[model samples]
Target: MALILSQLFISLILSLFFSLTLLPHATTSKANSSSEYSITSIFNVTAANHKTSQILSFKPFHNQEEFPQTFSSSSSFKLKLYPAASLYNTHHQHKNYYSLDLNASLNPGITTGTSNFLVQIGVGGPPQKFYMIFDLQTDFTWLQCQPCIKCYDQPDSIFDPSQSSSYTLLSCETKHCNLLPNSSCSDDGYCRYNITYKDGTNTEGVLINETVSFESSGWVDRVSLGCSNKNQGPFVGSDGTFGLGRGSLSFPSRINASSMSYCLVESKDGYSSSTLEFNSPPCSGSVKAKLLQNPKAENLYYVGLKGIKVGGEKIDVPNSTFTIDPYGNGGMIVSSSSLITMLENDTYNVVRDAFVAKTQHLERLKAFLQFDTCYNLSSNNTVELPILEFEVNDGKSWLLPKESYLYAVDKNGTFCFAFAPSKGSFSILGTLQQYGTRVTFDLVNSFVYLHTLCCN
Candidate 1:
């Protein structure tokens, strides 16, 4: 039977969103073991399959160069998280702006828009805790501050820079101010910025330098960030945005950390807060992959996706189907913001057919537009799912746990394959497939480490 798609898939294709955030500046676990980085913070992922207005087309600013190009690159950011860095500093001195969409409920019961995942962070000296979206795509970080000319209605008090003794304004001549995308000198001589988003959300305020802190790492001083005196847009839940991009201005790069990772906790209908570790070490039996760059979308994370293996058997598919184009087209992308893992049609079909065959015994259900393979297995039935092996060109293969690939749609035994086919040439290894695994984006070495994380 020819498969058809569903509203969920339609939404995945049409939906838009924003963000990324700080990885690790330090490290800490529940057992309180001192591991790699000095400072580490654990945040939560408000996992949900909420529906909203469909985003018709992906607006490319290079697009995802944040979601590292719209959630088809994380929709768009109010404080746009573009990858352009300060001219001089490719590492930390680059001119850039990034965003973090803290996953707080947006007018619950109203299907206007839906968001998932948020991380808790501390900003300023004697750091104030703020819950922000944990987006790993963009590089700019910001917070809604007081003395507001205009501000979004957030549950928490807007941060008052005046209350933080460590707050210091950036001068127009300062290297940090010079690095901002829309920074200018105010009449009063302080550096000012006006960040505009795709949906017309804008945050304008003074560029300031303050001490930002994390859990075990204590305080990192002179962190350049935005203190939005005037804020507007769909970002109405948390205090502000956080950067987790490749630009020098990104919190991870600024700290000069070698590596970091975020293990997305699976809490399918509800929010299960997870952890974000900076300078994280590789887990035992961890696999590695070289992090490639897409010239067409340089700001996003591009990796060499070799191919896939089903139940220890290699799926026969051409390498070019998963390759990065010389012109930088049609490469595979892995993003935490994107909800579905989209693959190029040719490759997806092969994987889909094999997956369906493996679970052929279970009673099949009508296809959800968003997912092609689905089954209505009884609660008491025991079916074995194929062990999905994702291969990276860097001589490593990452096995996706069952929870990462299969999703339960309802209280009954209705379940579906979480992977989807891309309408475009590229493929995205999205957050849905990333759950229950601890993966690290190694900044210094330009490699990624993947291993199963079963946090107690």
Candidate 2:
């Protein structure tokens, strides 16, 4: 009996030693009490999936000269998408503008310097590669061109239109020029476009038609895009923006894509990439929701968000809380660029109160950034958080996993509810809540499908 006990004790000690050694080292402080938790330690407590944990642990790129490219298949074009943080070292310096300010009277476009997913494409005849922000809110594919009058610094080399034999400047008389909002005719007869975003990021230059090549999916000829000679903003680390909105000039509309789908892995690991598919079917067992349209902003994707539930119990909010007004001032939009979900003030208050009530037993911490509801989980070994569910069109419940709605704010086991209050009447379902889910947009049928944890 003594010999058997000794062997078991030795095995247990070895296991514990290995586990302790494997734990990631983190820097913590009691004074400020706002330390970033190591990826391993946060995952250990939250039980988050490996993909999400990898995202939290991503390190900035060391090489600026090398650009990453996406690959595709033949039947349906599939471009690989990478989180902006993984490809650019400058993403950390920009302020987080995850929520849209619709009251400013500016239409939604690229939210200043904060772009989330990026796609790489080749422009011109010989196909010079450029990294562009994949945006779903606007529909003008634009990039900074050579001989720029004024341009912001980008990681890739400025695209020289003279180098590509297939590049042709669009004339002011062309139909494509008429599609632009504030288009004009240049002195040289070329079509000129001037677009100013809500955050003051503007791009002005001649519109052109060029051959854009995609890996494995061949090339698209005569695609209408902007060759900006004057562009300025905090557009760090990317060459330009590739609009995938519902406008006539959007990439999807230009390509005549029947349906589009994307699986956001949300990993900033340099090697990891997510797939953005054009003309693809939703995965098996997808929860379907009807797509809502707003006349004011027809290009943006709006969904019917009827109500919200916490721990399987519905919150008492009026039906008008998430409705779009007559002038299209209020609604819910699923945005790929926004970092965190934003709810209108009234609706947000109800949701926050529900979470606060459930977590009353836990220790409260100072509000972190935009998060007002936060907790300290340092002493607890295992914690059970309430599951959040969104009731969309057709009464379908879109369930959010614990990791999707709750995030570790520090290395000291401090966590915060991942939501913010919007300044306007509208609410935005941002990318953080879409992680590990496959969101499919079926334009033909006007439906959106959600496949939870499909990427994992």
Candidate 3:
């Protein structure tokens, strides 16, 4: 994720603070300290073109926290949050994934006073209709609202901080005051949050605490949120956001499981699977709590990368190609879903060129990208070139592919895509291409381990 302007402001302040404090020197000396974080290998598998496979497996946790010091205390470090649309496939028995409404026409569909699509924020099943950017890079859930606003249209229950009875705001002098990360504060002691997207969209308001009720027997109280008087764009449809990042500051303060797995896909394609799992051997019980690895400030978690083989020929890219910076700063967050989509398109582009050069049709390869949309397979009227077969991890290893798995489809069709949701860029592997694969994300390690498993 690329750093958003807002995050950049904070990074700069942090950078300056650490630079003068000899933090660079301190960093070297602290490498051996208990503060050092490490990620254990969970799972990995080989992957191939247009195929579903399982790569890695690891134990899932109920919750995890990120260290705030990960951000350098540099005044010049400007990081911003980019909001992105994500796909979540909520099926446990069947393969499923969320779908995105790609610019049906590439020309932002014209809408009435109401935007063509409505973004909603909900804790449980029912969606609270609101304008929001379904961000893939964010894990914390929050919303913009008044103490008592028009929540009658919400599909899910809405939180009325006024009635929360236990709702409390963090004092300007409270330890949680830093939760806002960015934004200004009001004289009334309300925390102000201002977020702007790369698309030039912006939202700002006073931060408040509230209750979020989810059907999973999990209810989060005292969650931080932005109560906006003038929320612009499609975000005004709901009360707040449902963050799915690795942080602990989102709505639904508590969950049955320590980890939250989300897969953002095209809304039109539906879900691929209902449940996602992270399985790894448990850490030694005697291991000190301090030994638990924390996510690196600049690192993000991602699945495996077996390497790419284009047209029976392997293409070499640095391991960094698969590494993601989940921090929503200047990093990446690629998923199997998006990889499928991208590889398909790229393969087709290559075949189109091959046919043109030979002045004859090259036999089309029997292949499928990861997406589940029918449009992807339909030539209907558009006769696009055939897709190319690229092996991930050189066919030796793979990310086990399931019918439905949650993943970030490739963002922006770029190979080295960076997903900075706070800036409104969510890098996902779309279903159009990513269909099968057991993928694992190591938030602590800057590597994607993949082990491909065949689709049943």
Best by lDDT: 2
Among these predicted structures, which one has the highest TM-score?
2
**Model 1 lDDT at residue 116:** 42
Candidate 3: where are CA atoms >4 Å away?
1-134, 147-158, 179-181, 236-239, 246-258, 263-306, 310-313, 316-320, 323-332, 335-396, 399-428, 436-456
Q: In candidate 1, where is summed lDDT lowest over 10 consecutive residues?
A: 64-73
- lDDT by residue for model 2 (1-456), tens: 886454333322211111110122454331111122221222245333233344444455623332224433254677777655556554445432112221232244445434466777888867788878878887889999988899877767799999998999999999999999799999999999998877777889999999877655666778999999898776766788888888898988888888888876643345334778888888776777778788877888887777888766789875666787788777788786555688878888999898777767778898865668888877765555555778765555776533565655444566678787876778888766776678889988888888765664
- Candidate 3 per-residue lDDT, tens place, 1-456, comes to 345443333222211111110011122122211222121111111111111111111111111111231112211111111112112112222211112223211111011111111233232112233333333344334554454333223222344445435455655555445655565667987666665543443456566555433322233445565555444444432334544344544331223223322222221122122123222312221111111112442112333333433223344544433334443322223422122233223333343344233322222222212222211211211122211222233233221122221121211110111111121222234332333322333333333333222122
Model 3 C-alpha RMSD to native: 17.2
- Model 1 deviation from native, Cα RMSD in Å: 13.7
Instruction: Please give the ranking of all candidate structures by lDDT, highest first, separated by commas.
Output: 2, 1, 3
TM-score for candidate 1: 0.72
**RMSD list, candidates in order:** 13.7, 11.9, 17.2
lDDT of 1 by residue, 20-128 (tens): 1112334334211112222212211112122111122222221111011101111111121111111012233221122222222111111112124555555665566
